[model samples]
Target: MMTKTKLPNKKLAIPKKKIAPKFRDAFIRFYRYMIFFGGRGGSKSTHIAILLLSRMMTDEYMYLVYCRKWSAHIKDSQFKIFQDCVKMMGWQDEFKFNQSDYSFVCLRNGNRAVAKGLDDNQKTKSIAEPTHIWVEEADQMTFDDFDTLNKALRSLKTQNSFILSFNTFINELHWIRTTIFDKEQQYELSEQFRNMDTYLNHSTYLDNPFINQEEYLQTLLMDNGGNESKIASDRYGLWGQMPNENPWLYAFDKEKHVRVIPFIPSYPIYLSFDFNKNPMTVKMFQMSPQKGLYDSFVHMIDEMEGTVVLREFCERIKAKYPFSPFFVTGDSSGQKKGEVGYESKHDSAYSMIKKHLGLSDKQMNPNGYNLTYENSRILMNQMFYNYPNLYIHPQCKVTINECEIATVDEKSMNVHELKKDRGTYAMDHFDNMRYFFQKYFQEFARSNYHATK
Candidate 1:
């Protein structure tokens, strides 16, 4: 007892440094893959950047790399995080910044960080397997493109991690949902980040403490009262598509399917046509002169290929309707010259129409056109919602699907949004449908619709 007389009392010390909560916690979270998802300005990039630097601060020879899609893009947007956090954390001049390439690191510790973007396949093919991978704006790249990048991460044999941060304008229809959101699925991320084992850590801009606490900042100030969904999708990390964003889009709901048109009218017949070489599209509408609108109940659709075959489909539709007062409304697109390097698809189609079939001549009317792309977008997007008489034929699924997904690239699609014929055939039919409506509307005011005595 005498020998055990108290050893000199020793004081216990605690860590004076404070964890930022997001990065500090993510560092300990056990998951093979960690996803930080939320609305805009949610501090996702900052959190991950801090975490990567923290790992570097602790150890030597740490393989730390950050990337987006292109090498040029990364050094600017993603590289800034490394530069800022290193300085903030007091890693001073210890790190090297290469202005000419996509690699850098702190000299004091053997930790290195690289930043780059995946703008093309060759760039992706050149990357070495990363110990950790960060993909920003993952939604911008196609599933196939991102999948290609994943190959580089496989080189990490021990303690490797993949971190994803993004704001999605696209929704559950994407592959990410199936891979990560589904309940029964298992992820490699679970080994390191414990939270990954439970469920996805879905965060939003509001959840981020960095945002200004006041209610009147940024998105809160946006004035889109009637278009709240659009605001949410665009500004708040929600999807751009509303429940019925496109009125022409048909619901698969069996409950809404009425075999018979609830209201039929004795009115003048009208026609709307959209033409395509692959699958032609045509729509028919009934005019209501009293209301200055078309009747939704009377319509038709035809989508078939080949001149003789499509012509037959067109004739068959006309015969079924059996109204000589029918009108054709339609549109055309400029196609790129192929191996022949001559006139485009629009030219070929115009030549075919003028040479063989005597279709309506008035296509782009000078009086009705808009002066700018912005104005044209407003006009085109407004059409589906404003027409009270516009209704989908219960059977015309193709046209309905077309109207829902047919997007116009306001800027040219040559670079970031390239697809020679992606999401196109549907558009052809839609163009035909719109053209037919315009044709009928041009002369409909004086037709039998207003002849009642």
Candidate 2:
């Protein structure tokens, strides 16, 4: 962490800007949990920075623990944002900045505002009973991480509020969405989290009074050519469906493909596997008896290895769909023998899925059509064309993200190749789906051909 300060030993006059009516209520209310979620240029960060600085200046007891997902980001982004705010509010002369501690101290009251990375255990440990905490980029945090911070914040005596600000990603199954945005889940949340008045406020660039309208409109027009999600999220500040940049599975659409559909117990659950020792992925697909197309709804990506992963999948399946039959399919590589021969006779993944799930040869689609990469792409695209037939559930967030977010490599023309622009650990679930698609589509095409003949 690095810090710089400019103090002239005299208090400077603050400027008065026309505050928007929508923000007035938030400024006054003292909610236990305050969430400001929306698209870019929403002034969520700006308003909160103002509020924090105002409290520090007025109250002698005010203390804050401001955090970002990565500690390094604190210095470059939020730190600078606050530094600018301090200047904007004309409080530069009355505050003392400590670069070593990554904190700011009010010269008059001795009040302190600390900045840290949530992932930095050392910095988090230093945050002793902070009354207020603002987690910037809250979407990157996991549920467990949020729970830990929540518990820590509750133990404090002074501050009554904890704030989280983020832009909504396409993954509807994110913990933030499930716990905060979903109306049905609010009851469950209220029961678990007693005495906490949770408030969720959404805003966008359009709602922001300070935003440059002319510049924003020009940017929106540039993005309007094909990037609907960007226009929706950045310009309008809505939680848009997705942004498909150089998409590999180009046919996936939120309107046509994503929905809530019930699973049929009569239909056997088809499992597809992607065998990486670290992040082994398994996807579930079952044909809809009524709709006459496959419904891929479940996705499991585990860090465990070998039979343990298979056992975990089996346990989860049994718990979710107890009576439903389990069928297995996957990459041809799963058929190979493993070095861990001491545990069972069959060391391969397909054998483990069979043994653990109690699936016989009839239940397993071994080899999975053995389609070439080009043939697999063609088959998937063909299935995608029949939009009404194929569907994915909202709960399969990672799978949906992979299918929609995946892009083609410039050189190899391969979808799975990780790029600098697109981060890693994304294509595993999508690859698992490919194995199932190749096998099931071949059978589907064959059956239709026979019926026509």
**Per-residue lDDT of model 2, residues 164-265, tens digit only:** 998754455455666666446532343323345666667777767787877877876686686777677777666665545567566667687777766766
Q: Candidate 2 — which pairs collide? A: none
TM-score of each: 0.52, 0.63
Task: Output the number of the lDDT-best candidate.
Answer: 2
| The best candidate in terms of TM-score | 2
- Candidates in order have lDDT scores of 0.49, 0.66
The window of 10 residues in a row where model 1 has the poorest summed lDDT is: 1-10
Q: After the best TM-score superposition of candidate 1, give how far the Cα of residue 42 lies from its true spot, in angstroms.
A: 1.9
